[model samples]
Target: MNRSAEMADLSGTIEVARVVLVIGLVFLHYFAYPNSRVPPFEGFDPNHHQVATFVNSFVLFFFFSAVPLLSTISGWLFFGFSARPWEAIRRRIGKRGWSLFVPLVIWNLGALAIAFALRAVAPTSSLLGPFGIDFAHFGLWDGVDAVLGLTRLPVAFQFWFVRDLFVTVLASPLLWLMLRHAPLLAAAALCVAWLADFTFFGLFIRTDVLFFFYLGALARLRGVEPRVGWNTTKLLLLVYVVLMALRALAPLAFDPSQPDQREMLDLFTRLARPLGVVACWGLCLRLAATAWGEVIGRYGGFAFFLHAAHFPLIIFVKFVLWRLVPAETDAWMIAHYAAS
Candidate 1:
């Protein structure tokens, strides 16, 4: 194939991978509702409940890589196409402001407005939490906190990715320059930052965004591409199995509340996510050589729309379920999972 055709094939493969990743994210969000802890499913048969818990844990273990993979792909595309760094950064910021920032603000406002309406209509419903616009309790500072993602009241919790993406894109030019000039040092600095945040502050700084974004830029600079053959694919599959095992055993190995344990898990996650991304990318690249891959690529852009709109739909479904079934009940949980 010609150079243009090759690039087009790569783009299509990435898009197909993105679509699959987003679907996995939807499933992750669905199953991870209430909390990351697997529910006991009380009153059910012990064997069946144990099986369900194990399945849930297994699924969530691998699903953790989706966001990192998305971030890396975004970085790759952003830097790969840019001829002039500053001009590209300026263009990207403007585009993302309209496409990302504006949507985030609108969504947050819309969610708050809907919550207020719900509270007004059904005063007894347990829907509204800190999101309710009670001037007496919720002040301007609280609104600021909500907008900044310190509080998940006004904004959909899923939009944290949007916020992080905006920040990463805004800083992409500088990161790109650093990677070009002193790649190793830049990577080391990012790793230190990530470690500090994960160890000390519990990831309040969101260095995962920076780490994966820069990793993508570095991959582009190094001309990295997926070249998985049968043997390599089998090796990667083994790596994936080992990663899943570690993820499943995490809770049993250490208390999540411990800083050291949290740090260890975070480090393990950093390793596992990129490995998963590579494995998924290789598979997508192989698929992209087929006819159906083109069809999948055509619909891949819908993933962004799905990400933006699914949270509201989830909330609506949960509200309907809440009205029908008691909270914390097995029926309500099942309905929420299905709706998601």
Candidate 2:
């Protein structure tokens, strides 16, 4: 086939791959591990329930692994066909406008308002005793602490992809230049950066940041679509199965009052995490080749927003439902948890 025909085939294949990645992400978040444990009281206790663990193990893996893979690859394929980086981004931002930032601000404010309200009413469940800020803990710096407290908001963390994506969109032009010149090198650097953020700096460095996402975009942009052959896919699937088994067996290990569970997961997630992401993505891509795949492809643009909005949306809806039912035995909680 001619070069033009080959490029067209490549683009079509990438579109399919992108759809699969997006679907995999949605499944990982809602289906794979929904009620992730969050350590209560803030310590390294192994028995704590952790929200971060669920987000990282299920939601984050899909977001970081799949979305970047899809967006970057799709962007790259389109770029190869003559779309300019700035022009594409301009079009994207123009369509979305300032609507995207609304979620970030709303999530932040919502988290704070809820926390204070909870503290005033529920006290114990709302804030940890020794670790929490109380009347005694209050001082001139109380206000400053309050603002910083927003960073710890669990609901806000759910929409982290929004802040991260904003960074990616902003940096697209520079990322495009780098991808055009050196794609493999860019991917390698990003992998190193991710490892450093996860293992070394821990939560201080957010992998969801645009620079990391941009790296995935660069890989896809540079046309580095490695077709994982059937054998590779099978091997990856086997590894994923083992990891999920481990996950099921690994009971809630970290307490919120101690070491972050994310650190614990990051340490072990090293071996099987990437493998699972690749396998899941590969399977989705294959599935996307059918009529259903075409339907999924149409929703690709909305995936990021949906992923980011799920957490806040969940909380907002739950609060409304709580007002109606006003009981711990409310049936809505069951349905809400089951749905998202």
- Candidate number achieving the greatest TM-score relative to the actual structure: 1
Q: In lDDT terms, how accurate is model 2?
A: 0.50
Tell me the tens digit of each residue's lDDT in model 1 across 204-266: 336666787788878887888645665676678678967776566566555555777767776
Every candidate's lDDT: 0.67, 0.50
TM-score of 1: 0.81
Q: Which ranges of candidate 1 are over 4 A from the true structure?
A: 31-48, 123-126, 129-136, 148-154, 198-205, 252-263, 318-339
lDDT of 2 by residue, 219-282 (tens): 4555565456667777887777656545533445543234567566555654354665567556
* TM, every model: 0.81, 0.57
